[model samples]
Target: MSRKHLHVVDSSSFELNIPEAELELMEEMISAYEVRRLGSRNHKQKSVSSDTAVIRSFLTFIQKAPWNATTDDFDAWCYQIGREQKVATNSQRKYQSAVQGFYRYIVDNVKFQAAVLDRYNLRIIQLVTEENKIPHVHERQRTNERPAFTHQDFESFIGAIDVQIVEAYKFNSKEFLALQRDKVMFYSMYVMALRNSECCDLNLSSFRSNPNLPEFGDYGFASVWGKGSKGSGPKQRAVAIDHADLPPLLDWYVNDIRPQYLQKPHCDPNEEAFFLTERGSRMKSGSLNYRFKKILGYAGLSEKGFVPHCLRHTFTTHASSAGMSLEYSKIKLGHEYAATTQTYTHCGDEFVNREAVRYAQSIINRLSDDE
Candidate 1:
């Protein structure tokens, strides 16, 4: 199968004709890899999704390229496609990563030799540099800043969700179920600090209930399979349940609601996905986003640009403000780097003021003792 002839579809129903075993293997690799890297050092969730997408594209790209295609061929494809779309630098990096991961999988798992894989890796690195130096059609100035959110804005958003629930009561049962689902889903995304993919990929099996703990362990923590979690590295991490406000809704959905709704005979037994569409199928990433937007509007939180990830930002901000250690927060968030975790350290003015006061007190004490 040539890459050019390989069919990529925009709709969900479109299926590729790749061997079932191979396709299954690829999916397993993606899932298993994510699980292993979840709590490991140097594991990044963002890179995982990008890499998977890249590898899928690469499979098609390779099928189309000439049998005699060399490193130059790969380089050309990246430049042409990447420039045509005016992809950002980070996107280019992800494309490179995906190709590299694909070749690595081929070498490590398939009939290909290790030497060939090593050479391909080297070739990819060389090509990435070559392509990066050639400016794309849209070369915008790079900004080194990160996005920040204040504590008050976070509180206001949560307050708005409370208001939404009252309005939701006015709707009938079915409409109210949809409304509550969206509300709880947004809350889960923020409280759990999950990526869009992680949020969408969740299944009933991911939640493990333990009713025996001193506190309400009835709502067990979720096992998250992070991005780039395939192959040899660590991939899975657990998010502990703590907040009193969030757990009841989560438990309700997991134990009572999901089983009632997803128990239809048409529902695939193999698919134990936690979130479902009204038609009783596993939710797609797009649906998750749609639901998120709908709920945000209902909550009057649309003004905050309250996307799915903003919830994650909310988690980090709240955790940091609560005085959780940076190291602990990194582990909880499943971030591989302290630097990536540091992006969430935007404390409230109260926290900043308290720290300032404490520091001043320490300084005064030190000076007085010296005198």
Candidate 2:
């Protein structure tokens, strides 16, 4: 447990005439919570800060300390906060979990719970429960609202990028190299099943030739720092680069366009970033989102509500359609479970029916051959 104090509330907004001992106890509790987060949870600074903020906001809303807060207080605060912030149900769930986790930590720690009881004669109980918490059953599972790009839409999107790259090159535009980079970036996201941050964090050393995939040269697989489960850390994995066009495009960009960017006056000679900007640094996630929208507009699919993550989903759905097994797709996408990968597979009803017919035809042909 740490002695560092947490700013639980603004003194000006909510004044409380409390004894020094009680205030000290509250501060100690917050410090201990932070210690648990840092040591046991392995939470990063952003996660720790966000969790603390949520706890502080909940305490402020309840107008009481953690031990004194009740389910009614939690319910009231949850409702008011959700309405006031205009956050989605998922966001509300996160807020609830943060507070809920704090309660759990205090309740489960026998020494801490005993101290609070001995001094203040009060006990903290878990406020968020299965009944009270906002359900994620429908949101996480079932059909995802974030639709994957249909095959035709993907083609149109890539084709539009191609036209932009060619046009930029022909005019000797300053953005010509950027357009080429964007082509590889976006296509790689789709084919490699990369998250936006993962794609941006890529280094020149990330790609290596898979001995089994020698034809792809050194671009056969991309080793990415993948998104982690919980707040653990970056999960690294090698995604196989199977798409034919992807290897050549990536090779061209790396050997040709990438060097040109590195030669910019302000560029760092030793910069290892695979995706470099004109400013001589790694490409930021925000820039990726902005470029994605621009390309979406060019593809005439801007109104379809597609996002960068949708590219991963598009790959999942498209790969399954192209005969990739569910288990293999899960491995390639670095998903923890096959069930999680299943959620990303959003093959249309038409495709399902087509597959059904094809399967039945295969069975019939086999029976006829036996006869």
Candidate 3:
């Protein structure tokens, strides 16, 4: 049977002539535009999905207004919705843009009038100004603090995890499968420095055992579907792995744990997800967080203010501490700019002091020779 079609309702008049196919096409176009914002690094699908959600919310609200609604109508709607929902300024801006973009699309493609488009733009600006009137107190407070992690603190955390694993595994009844999985996951996140979503969406098939160019010392690599990769952008990137160092962990996951998990009667091998739950279902963002929290507690680490993204931060920090060049780090992190990678270079004072002492010694020797 054919699926029931979706419709995009015109909020102003409660008109619902938009067909599901048209809505889907419009959503695809908006998603394309959103992915374009990422510049590069291939996260198109994520961007599209985000934009689609934002636009869908805006459309649902807009369709409730009169068909001949004026700028005042749009403005009033924005203020009412913004205040009612207590939406943040950034969120309000997104909604406004979504509404404006939807109208622009209708105008350009559906023969919507210039006047209607002008009204939409005017309402967006008005809403933006209204939203900005509230002071961004939280942002002002956060301006002085950097968002990256420090090398020493990160190492301490890892060391803490190691100690916990030794202690916890001694008493656990479930054979430490979960603990092992978390350790591998944590190591993979730090070693590869993947975004949480990228890690979550990774597929077992993407792990190549005998990757190309093995003679050049190339080892296994993961074909990651990065940001802007879903729609029309770069779909995949081959991230090289130091297989000699990391391969055994992947081997344990794929050959040992994965097989046992998949052998269950209800397991869905075709799900295309690398991570699975105890029930053999595909792992989700929430499950990743739950696992991360459980592991953090087991490792005797404080869960407060700790986020999974910190693993990415820890990777970059440790790499910088090890004297890895910023350019190399940037490339490995899939960052488009050197500055983005620079944020992760929170080296400890000891590193700075050691470098300073070396420099001073070199200067002293040179001066003595000159005398």
Candidate 4:
């Protein structure tokens, strides 16, 4: 018999009942693996705990010890969780990796492998094989693709914000000042093509005047720390404040609205953050996402799957349609590659139709002149 067939037959004949001694060995194996990961890999306790949970789940699903788990069992478990539970592809990969890591730990420790084999008469083998495992990808993956907002949708969204602000002010609602801050926050994200974290991380001194753009005063350009690559730190860039209305609005917020936040109880007078909560702390990314979702629903766009990141995509698309060069857009958005900026630009069908009509009109004019 083939080695694989012999092993499968052996695993089949073993008693299904797991003794207390076997359970202790399994727990010991997991604990040793966790210690190795914590010391050598510097994995966080939460991550280690997650790995342990994944191994236990796989064990429960297979109804066998890790040593007796076959590739078929692993594949069936993957299909059950992936198809039935509808887990995301990235999450599926993470779970697969955790199991693979555990098996690797077993294979490397001969003493542990022998302990399990001698006790249970079953040997641990690599379960995650090339044909069965989900391939690791370096590029970021989005399970749900978020579409960019159309111009009408964006206008309606902004109009909703304005209308709510007016109502809040008229009724003297406690959120009146907060709504104003959110308006500026959303506007800045779109106009500057800023990531939500970058917007939330802004401070009072993040903006400064450009000598060439005298009309903008001190609100000419915003210096922000852009999102970095996997291990690298934040990449700093100066995003030019190009919109005519934004500078004045920013000036108004700085002079009028921001001070109100500072006046709250226990607020630090020396706090340098540009956007502050009613509690006087800097705005968090989660809070910004929650607020954006509320505004999206108010604007009747909640069903459209639009997230705050779509604002950055909207900026790139609108900028491209408005005759901004792709190279400039790349620089403005702090993208390392022009191709990355291209991915963000999702122009609508109207822009394409308009360009086609303009091209045909130019051709007709040329024919008339020739005649």
Candidate 5:
């Protein structure tokens, strides 16, 4: 009865079906998805593309209507996405959510139920859960590996990096290049929750103006190219920087401090590397680990297992306590799966309380401003 049913590409042309009526219903369900997604002004193209691909692939692979898909079919398709297609685990989880959400929409869509269930006793059920995805924390994280950094510890770490620059010489003088570079690198990595490589790979041109967040100016979103190891070619996702405090820091580094570090003889003038060593070139992930070691030592934190990756862990823990959701945190971390994000998330009462009050006040201010 919905407008989507009238607009389906094909009314009935499927080989396999619970019945002709069921197949038409499935088409209507898919049309509904297309309509809703297309109608949204802020539609995520990547999400829509992947969700449609999952549904169509499963439909073709199983040669069955979606309403009749069994748990076994869902399992087999997952195996294909994981092993055969070499999709990242997080991506696989995303695809599963997409599939589940679509089915939920189809079944729960009360207005269209008569079109779907007139003949076949149809039901759509979720096939993914926390246990199924790889969120089980490995034993190493629990015992030997460095624990996620607390908010106070993160502040100490930044202070540790900055104190080196302060102690060495006047700020931004020739004596300060290395320390300044490291300081900016450390904070930028923290702000974006970037993996070491993603941080290192970042070029000056990578920062672009996002119109949606005009207040952050040109440095709000970070589009990081990563996750190639999981067999899906280099993945790129944009992360929004919470920039109430980041702009001035990033600006000082980009304008004043960065040029000082790029003064090596015969340095590529066009070289846009965001973080650079004295010799100049992309700063490798290993160099970042060395810097972490040095800074952690200065801060009196054990540097043995506390590596650059731990900065990412620290970012996640701090962000979660600051009221960032697991979904946005995953995007910030460039994680394919939310479980991988949960592996790093920790919250302390202090940070949560501070963030909660700030957020509540912000809401109150907005309401007042409206008046």
Candidate 6:
């Protein structure tokens, strides 16, 4: 059991008596929830810790065990958080997510439900509803959170990584190999706009040459297992890596740089991971994060409230600014809804004005050709 658990009852609240078995179930659910949260989402500590706090707060507010709580109880708890606590909309949604996961465990996990019911004669019910969910306001619009990095900024970041690679090579440092891999990993991410987990999960089989575009070689398409909502599991999508510049970079990395990471004496020749760790195992999202942080630090980027996922935002903004159609960008980014993809776009005024002129000039040129 997590010793970090919080007390769920107060002296002022109605006295509550939970069966030992039921209490144990709650603890177990918390433990399992932590594992599930860490495994699926890239959230490390904040999810498990904050979720536990949210669960404890919900339990304390209700003054009853989870199974005994009703939808009305949950509705009130949400109301209190938003109205009294005045947490930001995003915080409310996080609370929703934590509670939703608990209820899902209670409702879906047959073993958990059976054990609790057999021992305590209690049935767990989902108290959360769509009615309880806070509407998602696009943070890009609202708080100016991590305004998408411009293409120039993204280039600077990649260039900084390049400089580090050169410096490591100059020193003949062992870090040269790892820096080379980071370059490919981050470059692919920027050009293709892959999620951190998606990029981390890449293996040799994830790429294929577009027969029609022989120049791109095996870099024309990338298979991505993208994140879906909780319990939806990962949905597979194909991202088109058709940009002319992207293909050459990917080709260079695959042919030249990737083999270096695989050359250890003990390294398995059959290891198919596109990106390998120092140990020759597949790269993990956390490892990807460390390299991402190093890139950000070298690029002199502010690390506050930013993560590797922001690269996806940068890709979306740059793609839109460059006149990629929303439908094309939506499919490329693996967003199910066009509106969701819009939230990632952060095109600036200059790009908008330049693009307007380009569009006008193209139409004028077309008219001249017609004449």
lDDT of each: 0.61, 0.84, 0.60, 0.83, 0.71, 0.78
lDDT of 3 by residue, 34-61 (tens): 6444554344555555555655555455
CA shift of 93, model 3, Å:
6.1
What lDDT is reached at residue 275 by model 2?
91
Give each model a TM-score. Answer: 0.60, 0.73, 0.59, 0.63, 0.56, 0.64
Q: How many backbone clashes does candidate 4 have?
A: 0
Structure candidate 4, residue pairs in collision: none
1 or 6, greater by lDDT: 6
State in Å the error of residue 149, model 2. 1.7
Among the numbered candidates, top TM-score falls to 2
TM-score of 3: 0.59
Error of 3 at 317 (Å): 0.6
Measured by lDDT, the strongest candidate is 2
Clashes of each: 20, 0, 18, 0, 2, 0
Model 4 worst lDDT run, 10 consecutive residues: 2-11
Residue 290, model 2: Cα distance from true site in angstroms: 4.0
Instruction: Write out the backbone clash pairs for model 6.
Output: none
C-alpha lDDT of candidate 3 relative to the true structure: 0.60
Please provide, for model 4 over 162-195, each residue's C-alpha lDDT reduced to its tens digit, 9 standing for 90 to 100: 9999999999998799889988999999998889
Give the per-residue lDDT of model 2 (tens digit) for 1-371: 22123233243454434566776777788889888888877878778767777787777676677788899999898777667555666667877888888888889989889998997788778898989999876735444657899999999999998999889888999878888888888999999989989999999899999899888898998898887765568889988998877899888988888898878787888999999888879999999999999999999999998889999999999999888999989999999989889999888899899999999999999999999
lDDT of 1 by residue, 289-308 (tens): 88766655655666665567
The regions of model 5 sitting more than 4 angstroms off are 1-144, 170-175, 348-371
